[model samples]
Target: MTDEAELLQRLWNREKNSIDEAIQIYTPYLSTVLYYMAGNSLPKEDIEEIVADVFIVLWKNAGRIDSVRFTIFL
Candidate 1:
């Protein structure tokens, strides 16, 4: 399986550092998406907050997640 798949598994297991890895990988993508979704009008802090909340949600729901499903969900 792909590295991202492994990461998703780790997230499901609540392995330490998995969320950090996920944040590193997805934060930029999330930020850019949020920017465009908000018409690029949101302040940087607001974008950051939204991105953080996304990760937190992922962590909370990781047990039911898989990379394929998550990529589609994202």
Candidate 2:
């Protein structure tokens, strides 16, 4: 499997760094999504909070998530 695939598997298994890797790889895209979703009305602090919430959701749901699937889902 590819590195990202391995990372995804690790994330599914609850490995600590897996979420970090995912965040590093996907934050820019996720930020853009959050920004757009908020209609650009959010301040920097609010945007940061929303991004944190996104990562928290990802961590909470990691077992059921496929990173590749989420790449598309995002």
Candidate 3:
């Protein structure tokens, strides 16, 4: 299976490490996107807060997430 697939599966199973893996994999991408979307107005700390909120939402909804629809979470 693809790495993302495996990660999603682990997330669905509530594996603690899966969240770490996800943050490692996605944080840079999300941070960049958020930074750009924020138009450089928000502080780094605000961007970090938004990113954390995103991960929290992802974790809360992991069980209902479709493995094939992983991109939806992002």
TM-score of each: 0.83, 0.73, 0.89
Tell me the tens digit of each residue's lDDT in model 2 across 1-74.
66767877888999998899888988888788878888758887888887888889989987996667755543
Point out where model 1 deviates above 4 Å.
67-74
Please tell me which predicted candidate would have the highest lDDT against the true structure. 3
Clashing residue pairs in candidate 3 (N, C-alpha, C atoms within 3 angstroms): none
Which prediction has the highest TM-score against the true structure?
A: 3
| RMSD per model, one decimal | 2.7, 3.1, 2.5
For candidate 3, the lDDT comes to 0.91
Q: Indicate the TM-score of model 3.
A: 0.89
Candidates in order have lDDT scores of 0.87, 0.82, 0.91
Of candidate 2, the 10-residue stretch with the lowest lDDT total is 65-74
User: Cα deviation in Å at residue 13, candidate 3?
Assistant: 0.6
